[model samples]
Target: MRQFDRGEIHARLRAVMDRGEPIVMGGAGIGLVAKAAERGGIDILMAYNTGPFRMAGHGSLAGYLAYGDANAMTLELGREILNAVDDTPVVGGIGAADPFRDIGRLIGEMMDLGFSGITNVPTTGLYDGKFRAHIDATKLGYPREIDLIRMCRDRDVFTVAYAFSTDEARAMAEAGADIIGAHVGLTSGGWIGAAATLDIDRACEATQAMLEAARAGRADVLVVAHGGPFEDPESVRSVFERTDVVGYLGASSIERLPVERAVSGVVRDFKALRPRATRTAG
Candidate 1:
Protein backbone atom coordinates (compact mmCIF):
# COMPACT_ATOMS: atom_id res chain seq x y z
CA MET A 1 0.00 0.00 0.00
CA ARG A 2 2.86 2.30 0.83
CA GLN A 3 5.44 3.41 -1.71
CA PHE A 4 8.78 1.87 -0.77
CA ASP A 5 12.27 3.21 -1.11
CA ARG A 6 15.36 1.10 -1.65
CA GLY A 7 16.30 1.32 2.03
CA GLU A 8 12.78 0.41 3.11
CA ILE A 9 12.76 -2.68 0.91
CA HIS A 10 16.15 -3.81 2.20
CA ALA A 11 15.32 -3.12 5.86
CA ARG A 12 11.93 -4.82 5.69
CA LEU A 13 13.47 -7.83 3.97
CA ARG A 14 16.26 -8.01 6.57
CA ALA A 15 13.74 -7.77 9.37
CA VAL A 16 11.72 -10.59 7.87
CA MET A 17 14.86 -12.70 7.56
CA ASP A 18 15.97 -11.87 11.11
CA ARG A 19 12.75 -13.36 12.44
CA GLY A 20 13.79 -16.71 10.89
CA GLU A 21 10.91 -16.60 8.44
CA PRO A 22 12.55 -16.75 5.03
CA ILE A 23 11.12 -14.02 2.82
CA VAL A 24 9.76 -15.64 -0.33
CA MET A 25 9.81 -13.27 -3.27
CA GLY A 26 9.05 -14.49 -6.75
CA GLY A 27 11.62 -13.78 -9.42
CA ALA A 28 10.00 -12.59 -12.68
CA GLY A 29 6.61 -12.18 -14.31
CA ILE A 30 5.25 -9.51 -11.98
CA GLY A 31 1.62 -10.63 -12.39
CA LEU A 32 1.24 -13.16 -9.59
CA VAL A 33 4.22 -12.32 -7.38
CA ALA A 34 3.40 -8.65 -7.18
CA LYS A 35 -0.10 -9.45 -5.97
CA ALA A 36 1.36 -12.03 -3.59
CA ALA A 37 3.70 -9.43 -2.11
CA GLU A 38 0.97 -6.85 -1.65
CA ARG A 39 -1.59 -9.18 -0.09
CA GLY A 40 0.83 -11.46 1.76
CA GLY A 41 3.15 -8.71 3.00
CA ILE A 42 6.03 -10.39 1.19
CA ASP A 43 8.83 -8.65 -0.68
CA ILE A 44 8.82 -8.68 -4.49
CA LEU A 45 11.79 -8.90 -6.86
CA MET A 46 11.64 -9.12 -10.65
CA ALA A 47 14.41 -10.00 -13.10
CA TYR A 48 13.69 -9.13 -16.72
CA ASN A 49 14.92 -11.54 -19.37
CA THR A 50 16.94 -9.83 -22.10
CA GLY A 51 17.94 -13.14 -23.68
CA PRO A 52 15.58 -12.63 -26.60
CA PHE A 53 17.55 -9.62 -27.68
CA ARG A 54 20.76 -11.61 -27.71
CA MET A 55 19.14 -14.51 -29.52
CA ALA A 56 17.77 -12.18 -32.17
CA GLY A 57 21.35 -11.14 -32.98
CA HIS A 58 22.53 -7.76 -34.34
CA GLY A 59 20.11 -7.70 -37.28
CA SER A 60 17.20 -7.81 -34.87
CA LEU A 61 18.52 -4.75 -33.08
CA ALA A 62 15.67 -2.74 -34.61
CA GLY A 63 13.23 -4.36 -32.21
CA TYR A 64 15.18 -2.88 -29.30
CA LEU A 65 15.23 0.50 -31.01
CA ALA A 66 11.47 0.61 -30.59
CA TYR A 67 12.01 -0.31 -26.94
CA GLY A 68 11.06 -3.87 -27.95
CA ASP A 69 7.60 -2.63 -28.80
CA ALA A 70 7.63 -4.40 -32.16
CA ASN A 71 6.79 -7.50 -30.18
CA ALA A 72 3.51 -6.24 -28.75
CA MET A 73 2.61 -9.74 -27.63
CA THR A 74 5.59 -9.87 -25.31
CA LEU A 75 4.70 -6.46 -23.92
CA GLU A 76 1.14 -7.64 -23.40
CA LEU A 77 2.45 -10.69 -21.59
CA GLY A 78 4.51 -8.44 -19.37
CA ARG A 79 1.43 -6.34 -18.73
CA GLU A 80 -0.56 -9.44 -17.78
CA ILE A 81 2.12 -10.23 -15.25
CA LEU A 82 2.14 -6.71 -13.86
CA ASN A 83 -1.63 -6.50 -13.74
CA ALA A 84 -1.83 -9.27 -11.13
CA VAL A 85 0.13 -7.28 -8.57
CA ASP A 86 -0.79 -4.05 -6.83
CA ASP A 87 1.77 -1.45 -5.82
CA THR A 88 4.63 -3.85 -6.43
CA PRO A 89 7.67 -2.32 -8.11
CA VAL A 90 8.59 -3.98 -11.38
CA VAL A 91 12.33 -4.50 -11.89
CA GLY A 92 13.13 -4.57 -15.58
CA GLY A 93 15.72 -5.77 -18.13
CA ILE A 94 18.31 -8.05 -16.57
CA GLY A 95 20.61 -8.58 -19.55
CA ALA A 96 20.89 -5.81 -22.13
CA ALA A 97 23.39 -4.54 -24.70
CA ASP A 98 23.06 -1.00 -23.36
CA PRO A 99 21.81 -1.27 -19.81
CA PHE A 100 21.40 2.45 -19.31
CA ARG A 101 19.29 2.84 -22.40
CA ASP A 102 17.21 -0.23 -21.59
CA ILE A 103 16.73 0.87 -18.00
CA GLY A 104 15.64 4.31 -19.10
CA ARG A 105 13.03 2.83 -21.41
CA LEU A 106 11.84 0.41 -18.74
CA ILE A 107 11.59 3.11 -16.09
CA GLY A 108 9.63 5.32 -18.44
CA GLU A 109 7.23 2.49 -19.22
CA MET A 110 6.78 1.64 -15.56
CA MET A 111 6.16 5.25 -14.71
CA ASP A 112 3.56 5.53 -17.48
CA LEU A 113 1.89 2.41 -16.13
CA GLY A 114 2.00 3.78 -12.55
CA PHE A 115 4.37 1.05 -11.34
CA SER A 116 7.00 1.41 -8.63
CA GLY A 117 10.82 1.18 -8.55
CA ILE A 118 13.04 -0.71 -11.00
CA THR A 119 15.75 -3.27 -10.23
CA ASN A 120 17.99 -5.43 -12.44
CA VAL A 121 20.88 -7.89 -12.89
CA PRO A 122 23.38 -5.74 -14.77
CA THR A 123 26.53 -7.86 -14.50
CA THR A 124 24.81 -10.87 -16.01
CA GLY A 125 24.89 -9.20 -19.42
CA LEU A 126 28.63 -9.44 -19.80
CA TYR A 127 29.20 -13.13 -20.38
CA ASP A 128 31.13 -12.53 -23.60
CA GLY A 129 34.35 -10.93 -24.77
CA LYS A 130 32.77 -7.98 -26.58
CA PHE A 131 30.57 -6.85 -23.71
CA ARG A 132 33.34 -7.61 -21.23
CA ALA A 133 35.80 -5.56 -23.23
CA HIS A 134 33.35 -2.66 -23.49
CA ILE A 135 33.00 -2.57 -19.71
CA ASP A 136 36.77 -2.82 -19.19
CA ALA A 137 37.66 -0.05 -21.61
CA THR A 138 34.95 2.19 -20.13
CA LYS A 139 36.57 1.67 -16.71
CA LEU A 140 33.16 0.49 -15.54
CA GLY A 141 34.52 -2.89 -14.36
CA TYR A 142 33.42 -6.31 -15.64
CA PRO A 143 32.16 -9.69 -14.44
CA ARG A 144 31.86 -7.53 -11.31
CA GLU A 145 29.98 -4.82 -13.18
CA ILE A 146 29.71 -1.28 -11.81
CA ASP A 147 28.14 0.95 -14.45
CA LEU A 148 24.59 -0.02 -13.59
CA ILE A 149 25.32 0.40 -9.90
CA ARG A 150 26.42 3.97 -10.54
CA MET A 151 23.47 4.66 -12.83
CA CYS A 152 20.84 3.34 -10.41
CA ARG A 153 22.45 5.12 -7.49
CA ASP A 154 22.46 8.38 -9.37
CA ARG A 155 18.76 7.95 -10.22
CA ASP A 156 17.84 6.85 -6.67
CA VAL A 157 16.34 3.66 -8.06
CA PHE A 158 16.32 0.38 -6.12
CA THR A 159 18.73 -2.12 -7.67
CA VAL A 160 19.61 -5.79 -7.22
CA ALA A 161 22.84 -7.07 -8.73
CA TYR A 162 23.30 -10.78 -9.43
CA ALA A 163 26.77 -12.06 -8.65
CA PHE A 164 27.67 -15.50 -9.94
CA SER A 165 30.83 -15.63 -7.81
CA THR A 166 31.94 -14.41 -4.39
CA ASP A 167 34.34 -11.94 -5.92
CA GLU A 168 31.56 -10.66 -8.13
CA ALA A 169 29.34 -10.12 -5.09
CA ARG A 170 32.06 -8.21 -3.25
CA ALA A 171 32.84 -6.05 -6.23
CA MET A 172 29.18 -5.19 -6.74
CA ALA A 173 28.85 -4.17 -3.10
CA GLU A 174 31.96 -2.05 -3.40
CA ALA A 175 30.50 -0.51 -6.53
CA GLY A 176 27.41 0.63 -4.55
CA ALA A 177 24.87 -2.05 -5.30
CA ASP A 178 21.82 -1.72 -3.06
CA ILE A 179 21.28 -5.46 -2.93
CA ILE A 180 23.76 -8.20 -3.82
CA GLY A 181 22.05 -11.44 -4.83
CA ALA A 182 23.81 -14.77 -5.37
CA HIS A 183 22.69 -16.34 -8.62
CA VAL A 184 23.44 -19.95 -7.87
CA GLY A 185 22.68 -22.34 -10.77
CA LEU A 186 22.02 -19.28 -12.95
CA THR A 187 23.32 -19.30 -16.50
CA SER A 188 24.23 -16.33 -18.67
CA GLY A 189 21.05 -16.67 -20.70
CA GLY A 190 18.63 -16.51 -17.72
CA TRP A 191 16.17 -18.94 -16.06
CA ILE A 192 15.38 -20.71 -19.33
CA GLY A 193 18.93 -22.05 -19.34
CA ALA A 194 18.96 -23.01 -15.65
CA ALA A 195 19.59 -26.74 -15.15
CA ALA A 196 16.91 -28.91 -13.56
CA THR A 197 19.46 -30.93 -11.59
CA LEU A 198 20.62 -27.94 -9.55
CA ASP A 199 20.66 -28.85 -5.85
CA ILE A 200 21.22 -27.48 -2.34
CA ASP A 201 24.85 -28.46 -2.32
CA ARG A 202 25.67 -26.02 -5.07
CA ALA A 203 23.32 -23.43 -3.59
CA CYS A 204 25.03 -23.66 -0.19
CA GLU A 205 28.48 -23.41 -1.65
CA ALA A 206 27.56 -20.29 -3.62
CA THR A 207 25.71 -18.67 -0.69
CA GLN A 208 28.55 -19.25 1.73
CA ALA A 209 31.08 -17.89 -0.70
CA MET A 210 28.90 -14.81 -1.34
CA LEU A 211 28.38 -14.20 2.39
CA GLU A 212 32.08 -14.44 3.04
CA ALA A 213 32.85 -12.04 0.24
CA ALA A 214 30.22 -9.51 1.33
CA ARG A 215 31.44 -9.59 4.90
CA ALA A 216 35.07 -9.36 3.90
CA GLY A 217 34.23 -6.23 1.98
CA ARG A 218 32.35 -4.91 5.05
CA ALA A 219 29.27 -4.50 2.93
CA ASP A 220 25.77 -4.78 4.30
CA VAL A 221 24.19 -6.52 1.34
CA LEU A 222 20.85 -8.28 1.14
CA VAL A 223 21.67 -11.71 -0.27
CA VAL A 224 19.23 -13.78 -2.35
CA ALA A 225 19.51 -17.12 -4.22
CA HIS A 226 17.84 -18.12 -7.45
CA GLY A 227 18.01 -20.10 -10.72
CA GLY A 228 17.42 -23.62 -9.42
CA PRO A 229 15.27 -26.13 -11.24
CA PHE A 230 12.74 -26.10 -8.42
CA GLU A 231 10.55 -29.22 -8.52
CA ASP A 232 8.53 -28.66 -5.34
CA PRO A 233 8.24 -26.78 -2.07
CA GLU A 234 10.68 -29.15 -0.35
CA SER A 235 13.38 -28.54 -2.92
CA VAL A 236 12.87 -24.80 -2.63
CA ARG A 237 13.02 -24.98 1.17
CA SER A 238 16.17 -27.06 0.96
CA VAL A 239 17.94 -24.20 -0.78
CA PHE A 240 17.00 -21.80 2.03
CA GLU A 241 18.13 -24.32 4.65
CA ARG A 242 21.51 -24.72 3.02
CA THR A 243 22.21 -21.04 2.61
CA ASP A 244 21.94 -17.73 4.44
CA VAL A 245 19.98 -16.34 1.50
CA VAL A 246 17.00 -14.23 2.56
CA GLY A 247 14.85 -15.14 -0.46
CA TYR A 248 14.65 -17.00 -3.72
CA LEU A 249 13.85 -15.85 -7.28
CA GLY A 250 12.86 -17.60 -10.52
CA ALA A 251 9.91 -17.90 -12.89
CA SER A 252 10.28 -21.17 -14.76
CA SER A 253 8.91 -23.28 -11.89
CA ILE A 254 5.74 -21.23 -11.56
CA GLU A 255 5.48 -20.59 -15.28
CA ARG A 256 5.38 -24.34 -15.91
CA LEU A 257 2.13 -24.62 -13.97
CA PRO A 258 -1.23 -23.75 -15.45
CA VAL A 259 -1.51 -20.00 -14.93
CA GLU A 260 -4.88 -20.24 -13.22
CA ARG A 261 -3.77 -23.11 -11.00
CA ALA A 262 -0.55 -21.33 -10.06
CA VAL A 263 -2.38 -18.13 -9.19
CA SER A 264 -4.94 -19.95 -7.02
CA GLY A 265 -2.20 -21.98 -5.35
CA VAL A 266 -0.23 -18.87 -4.52
CA VAL A 267 -3.29 -17.25 -3.02
CA ARG A 268 -4.07 -20.31 -0.90
CA ASP A 269 -0.48 -20.58 0.29
CA PHE A 270 -0.44 -16.90 1.28
CA LYS A 271 -3.64 -17.26 3.22
CA ALA A 272 -2.34 -20.31 5.03
CA LEU A 273 0.79 -18.46 6.06
CA ARG A 274 -1.02 -15.42 7.42
CA PRO A 275 -0.02 -14.66 11.01
CA ARG A 276 -2.47 -15.93 13.63
CA ALA A 277 -3.04 -12.40 14.94
CA THR A 278 -4.46 -11.51 11.56
CA ARG A 279 -6.45 -14.72 11.25
CA THR A 280 -9.72 -13.32 12.71
CA ALA A 281 -8.44 -14.05 16.27
CA GLY A 282 -10.20 -17.42 16.17
Candidate 2:
Protein backbone atom coordinates (compact mmCIF):
# COMPACT_ATOMS: atom_id res chain seq x y z
CA MET A 1 0.00 0.00 0.00
CA ARG A 2 1.09 3.54 -0.70
CA GLN A 3 2.00 5.71 2.29
CA PHE A 4 -0.65 8.37 2.95
CA ASP A 5 0.33 11.99 3.28
CA ARG A 6 -1.12 14.09 6.13
CA GLY A 7 -3.69 15.64 3.81
CA GLU A 8 -4.85 12.18 2.83
CA ILE A 9 -5.23 11.14 6.46
CA HIS A 10 -7.12 14.33 7.32
CA ALA A 11 -9.42 13.86 4.33
CA ARG A 12 -10.03 10.28 5.35
CA LEU A 13 -10.89 11.37 8.89
CA ARG A 14 -13.24 14.05 7.57
CA ALA A 15 -14.96 11.50 5.38
CA VAL A 16 -15.35 9.17 8.35
CA MET A 17 -16.84 12.03 10.33
CA ASP A 18 -19.21 12.84 7.48
CA ARG A 19 -20.56 9.30 7.71
CA GLY A 20 -21.20 9.87 11.43
CA GLU A 21 -19.04 6.94 12.33
CA PRO A 22 -17.32 7.09 15.68
CA ILE A 23 -13.58 6.81 15.32
CA VAL A 24 -12.71 4.01 17.74
CA MET A 25 -9.77 5.53 19.57
CA GLY A 26 -8.08 2.88 21.63
CA GLY A 27 -5.91 4.18 24.45
CA ALA A 28 -3.23 2.10 26.11
CA GLY A 29 0.40 2.02 27.08
CA ILE A 30 2.73 2.47 24.12
CA GLY A 31 3.46 -1.23 23.78
CA LEU A 32 -0.18 -2.35 23.89
CA VAL A 33 -1.39 0.30 21.47
CA ALA A 34 1.32 -0.59 19.01
CA LYS A 35 0.55 -4.28 19.37
CA ALA A 36 -3.21 -3.74 18.90
CA ALA A 37 -2.67 -1.52 15.90
CA GLU A 38 -0.41 -4.17 14.43
CA ARG A 39 -3.26 -6.65 14.79
CA GLY A 40 -5.58 -4.21 12.99
CA GLY A 41 -7.91 -4.10 15.98
CA ILE A 42 -7.96 -0.34 16.47
CA ASP A 43 -8.98 2.51 14.18
CA ILE A 44 -6.79 5.03 15.94
CA LEU A 45 -4.29 4.40 18.72
CA MET A 46 -3.32 6.89 21.46
CA ALA A 47 -0.02 6.32 23.24
CA TYR A 48 -0.59 7.85 26.69
CA ASN A 49 1.77 7.57 29.63
CA THR A 50 -0.15 8.77 32.68
CA GLY A 51 1.26 10.03 36.00
CA PRO A 52 0.78 6.72 37.80
CA PHE A 53 3.07 5.05 35.31
CA ARG A 54 5.77 7.49 36.28
CA MET A 55 5.15 7.03 40.01
CA ALA A 56 5.16 3.25 39.67
CA GLY A 57 8.64 3.24 38.15
CA HIS A 58 7.42 2.21 34.71
CA GLY A 59 10.28 3.63 32.64
CA SER A 60 8.29 6.84 32.17
CA LEU A 61 11.11 8.90 33.62
CA ALA A 62 13.53 7.18 31.32
CA GLY A 63 11.15 7.71 28.42
CA TYR A 64 10.85 11.39 29.31
CA LEU A 65 14.60 11.76 29.51
CA ALA A 66 15.01 9.84 26.28
CA TYR A 67 12.46 12.11 24.62
CA GLY A 68 14.21 15.21 25.88
CA ASP A 69 17.61 14.07 24.71
CA ALA A 70 16.30 12.38 21.53
CA ASN A 71 17.76 9.17 22.90
CA ALA A 72 18.23 6.50 20.27
CA MET A 73 16.64 3.78 22.44
CA THR A 74 13.41 5.75 22.87
CA LEU A 75 13.29 6.68 19.21
CA GLU A 76 14.03 3.17 18.03
CA LEU A 77 11.49 1.58 20.38
CA GLY A 78 8.81 4.08 19.33
CA ARG A 79 9.55 3.53 15.67
CA GLU A 80 9.67 -0.25 15.93
CA ILE A 81 6.30 -0.40 17.71
CA LEU A 82 4.65 2.06 15.34
CA ASN A 83 6.05 0.32 12.28
CA ALA A 84 4.37 -2.91 13.41
CA VAL A 85 1.00 -1.48 12.40
CA ASP A 86 0.75 -0.68 8.73
CA ASP A 87 -2.97 0.15 8.44
CA THR A 88 -3.79 1.90 11.68
CA PRO A 89 -2.54 5.45 12.25
CA VAL A 90 -0.45 5.37 15.41
CA VAL A 91 -0.52 8.79 17.11
CA GLY A 92 2.54 8.81 19.32
CA GLY A 93 3.43 10.81 22.48
CA ILE A 94 2.93 10.84 26.22
CA GLY A 95 -0.29 12.48 27.52
CA ALA A 96 1.44 14.71 30.08
CA ALA A 97 3.81 17.08 28.32
CA ASP A 98 3.60 20.41 26.47
CA PRO A 99 4.31 18.45 23.26
CA PHE A 100 6.01 21.29 21.41
CA ARG A 101 9.49 19.86 21.21
CA ASP A 102 8.46 16.38 22.30
CA ILE A 103 5.93 16.10 19.49
CA GLY A 104 8.43 17.38 16.94
CA ARG A 105 10.97 14.84 18.02
CA LEU A 106 8.40 12.04 18.08
CA ILE A 107 7.16 12.96 14.61
CA GLY A 108 10.65 12.98 13.24
CA GLU A 109 11.33 9.61 14.81
CA MET A 110 7.97 8.20 13.68
CA MET A 111 8.52 9.36 10.12
CA ASP A 112 11.84 7.61 10.15
CA LEU A 113 10.01 4.52 11.45
CA GLY A 114 7.26 4.92 8.78
CA PHE A 115 4.50 6.30 11.02
CA SER A 116 2.51 9.49 10.30
CA GLY A 117 0.78 11.25 13.19
CA ILE A 118 1.35 12.31 16.80
CA THR A 119 -1.08 12.96 19.71
CA ASN A 120 -0.75 14.78 23.06
CA VAL A 121 -2.62 16.85 25.62
CA PRO A 122 -1.34 20.46 25.42
CA THR A 123 -3.35 22.33 28.03
CA THR A 124 -2.92 25.95 28.97
CA GLY A 125 -3.23 24.69 32.55
CA LEU A 126 -1.19 21.64 33.36
CA TYR A 127 -2.90 19.09 35.56
CA ASP A 128 0.07 18.94 37.89
CA GLY A 129 1.94 21.83 39.49
CA LYS A 130 5.28 20.35 38.50
CA PHE A 131 4.20 20.14 34.89
CA ARG A 132 2.86 23.68 35.07
CA ALA A 133 6.09 24.83 36.67
CA HIS A 134 8.12 23.23 33.92
CA ILE A 135 6.07 24.95 31.23
CA ASP A 136 6.22 28.30 33.02
CA ALA A 137 9.94 28.05 33.61
CA THR A 138 10.41 27.37 29.95
CA LYS A 139 8.30 30.47 29.15
CA LEU A 140 6.29 28.58 26.60
CA GLY A 141 2.88 30.18 26.25
CA TYR A 142 -0.18 29.42 24.16
CA PRO A 143 1.77 30.81 21.22
CA ARG A 144 4.10 27.83 21.48
CA GLU A 145 1.04 25.63 21.14
CA ILE A 146 0.02 27.60 18.08
CA ASP A 147 3.50 27.10 16.71
CA LEU A 148 3.25 23.36 17.36
CA ILE A 149 -0.06 23.19 15.55
CA ARG A 150 1.37 25.08 12.61
CA MET A 151 4.31 22.73 12.59
CA CYS A 152 2.05 19.69 12.54
CA ARG A 153 -0.09 21.32 9.88
CA ASP A 154 2.96 22.00 7.76
CA ARG A 155 3.99 18.36 8.08
CA ASP A 156 0.42 17.27 7.37
CA VAL A 157 0.49 15.40 10.69
CA PHE A 158 -2.67 15.25 12.83
CA THR A 159 -2.58 16.97 16.23
CA VAL A 160 -5.07 16.10 19.01
CA ALA A 161 -5.34 18.47 21.96
CA TYR A 162 -7.19 17.48 25.13
CA ALA A 163 -9.07 20.27 26.88
CA PHE A 164 -11.01 20.20 30.13
CA SER A 165 -13.92 22.37 29.05
CA THR A 166 -15.70 23.69 26.00
CA ASP A 167 -13.89 26.95 26.45
CA GLU A 168 -10.59 25.14 26.54
CA ALA A 169 -11.51 23.14 23.45
CA ARG A 170 -12.40 26.29 21.59
CA ALA A 171 -9.19 27.93 22.75
CA MET A 172 -7.19 24.94 21.50
CA ALA A 173 -8.97 25.00 18.17
CA GLU A 174 -8.21 28.69 17.90
CA ALA A 175 -4.65 27.81 18.76
CA GLY A 176 -4.60 25.45 15.75
CA ALA A 177 -5.42 22.00 17.14
CA ASP A 178 -6.62 19.66 14.42
CA ILE A 179 -8.57 17.53 16.88
CA ILE A 180 -10.11 18.72 20.16
CA GLY A 181 -10.28 16.02 22.86
CA ALA A 182 -12.39 16.85 25.92
CA HIS A 183 -11.55 15.83 29.46
CA VAL A 184 -14.73 14.99 31.37
CA GLY A 185 -13.28 14.36 34.81
CA LEU A 186 -10.26 15.09 36.99
CA THR A 187 -7.75 14.72 34.24
CA SER A 188 -4.63 15.33 36.28
CA GLY A 189 -3.91 11.88 37.62
CA GLY A 190 -5.48 10.16 34.61
CA TRP A 191 -7.86 8.21 36.81
CA ILE A 192 -11.54 9.01 36.26
CA GLY A 193 -12.92 6.95 39.14
CA ALA A 194 -14.89 3.73 38.62
CA ALA A 195 -17.69 2.83 36.25
CA ALA A 196 -20.10 1.93 39.06
CA THR A 197 -19.47 5.22 40.82
CA LEU A 198 -19.56 7.38 37.70
CA ASP A 199 -22.31 9.98 37.51
CA ILE A 200 -23.83 9.36 34.07
CA ASP A 201 -25.87 12.54 34.14
CA ARG A 202 -22.80 14.65 34.81
CA ALA A 203 -20.89 12.87 32.09
CA CYS A 204 -23.66 13.65 29.61
CA GLU A 205 -23.67 17.27 30.70
CA ALA A 206 -19.93 17.48 30.23
CA THR A 207 -20.22 15.84 26.81
CA GLN A 208 -22.80 18.41 25.75
CA ALA A 209 -20.60 21.22 26.98
CA MET A 210 -17.67 19.83 25.01
CA LEU A 211 -19.76 19.55 21.86
CA GLU A 212 -20.98 23.11 22.26
CA ALA A 213 -17.41 24.25 22.75
CA ALA A 214 -16.22 22.42 19.63
CA ARG A 215 -19.06 23.86 17.56
CA ALA A 216 -18.29 27.34 18.83
CA GLY A 217 -14.66 26.91 17.91
CA ARG A 218 -14.24 25.21 14.54
CA ALA A 219 -16.85 22.90 13.06
CA ASP A 220 -14.28 21.44 10.72
CA VAL A 221 -11.97 20.26 13.45
CA LEU A 222 -12.59 16.74 14.83
CA VAL A 223 -13.94 16.46 18.37
CA VAL A 224 -13.24 13.39 20.51
CA ALA A 225 -15.00 12.71 23.87
CA HIS A 226 -12.87 10.85 26.40
CA GLY A 227 -12.09 10.31 30.08
CA GLY A 228 -13.90 7.49 31.72
CA PRO A 229 -16.03 6.14 34.41
CA PHE A 230 -18.65 5.31 31.83
CA GLU A 231 -20.21 1.96 32.79
CA ASP A 232 -20.98 0.41 29.47
CA PRO A 233 -21.46 0.90 25.77
CA GLU A 234 -24.92 2.36 26.45
CA SER A 235 -23.39 5.03 28.64
CA VAL A 236 -20.79 5.76 25.98
CA ARG A 237 -23.43 5.80 23.23
CA SER A 238 -25.52 8.27 25.22
CA VAL A 239 -22.68 10.80 25.18
CA PHE A 240 -21.90 9.96 21.56
CA GLU A 241 -25.48 10.74 20.58
CA ARG A 242 -25.26 14.28 21.89
CA THR A 243 -21.67 15.21 21.20
CA ASP A 244 -19.97 16.15 17.93
CA VAL A 245 -17.19 13.79 18.99
CA VAL A 246 -16.14 11.50 16.20
CA GLY A 247 -14.04 9.38 18.55
CA TYR A 248 -13.69 8.04 22.10
CA LEU A 249 -10.54 7.28 24.14
CA GLY A 250 -10.23 5.69 27.54
CA ALA A 251 -8.08 3.28 29.56
CA SER A 252 -9.69 2.93 33.01
CA SER A 253 -12.53 0.76 31.81
CA ILE A 254 -10.47 -1.38 29.48
CA GLU A 255 -7.56 -1.61 31.85
CA ARG A 256 -9.96 -2.89 34.51
CA LEU A 257 -10.28 -6.07 32.48
CA PRO A 258 -7.50 -8.48 31.60
CA VAL A 259 -5.66 -6.90 28.68
CA GLU A 260 -6.11 -9.74 26.21
CA ARG A 261 -9.72 -10.33 27.19
CA ALA A 262 -10.55 -6.63 27.04
CA VAL A 263 -8.97 -6.34 23.63
CA SER A 264 -10.83 -9.36 22.29
CA GLY A 265 -14.11 -8.19 23.80
CA VAL A 266 -13.76 -4.74 22.26
CA VAL A 267 -12.90 -6.19 18.87
CA ARG A 268 -15.90 -8.50 19.11
CA ASP A 269 -18.18 -5.65 20.09
CA PHE A 270 -17.00 -3.60 17.15
CA LYS A 271 -17.60 -6.48 14.78
CA ALA A 272 -21.05 -7.14 16.24
CA LEU A 273 -22.11 -3.59 15.55
CA ARG A 274 -21.52 -3.93 11.83
CA PRO A 275 -24.69 -4.21 9.74
CA ARG A 276 -25.38 -7.56 8.22
CA ALA A 277 -25.66 -7.64 4.49
CA THR A 278 -28.95 -8.62 2.86
CA ARG A 279 -29.02 -11.85 0.96
CA THR A 280 -29.59 -11.05 -2.73
CA ALA A 281 -29.74 -13.55 -5.56
CA GLY A 282 -26.19 -14.41 -6.47
Clashing pairs in 1: 31-81, 35-85
**Candidate 2, residues 20-54: lDDT per residue as tens digits?**
77766654444644565446455665554442243
Regions of candidate 2 where Cα sits further than 4 Å from its true position: 1-3, 18-20, 30-33, 37-41, 51-77, 94-106, 121-146, 186-198, 254-282
**How large is the C-alpha RMSD of every model relative to the true structure?**
10.5, 10.3
TM-score list, all predictions: 0.64, 0.67
Report the poorest 10 consecutive residues by lDDT, candidate 1: 54-63
How far out, in Å, is residue 35 in model 2? 3.8
Candidate 2, residue 8: the lDDT equals 70
Q: Per-residue lDDT tens digits of candidate 1, residues 1-282?
A: 334666776677777778887766554443544465457554664534432332233211232244653323234435655666665555544333343446456555653543345444334333447865776666544532456555666777676776767777787777667666666653222323433444567666767788679656655666766654443456667767777766665444433333435557899998789686777975
Clash pairs for candidate 2: none
**Top-lDDT structure, candidate number:** 2
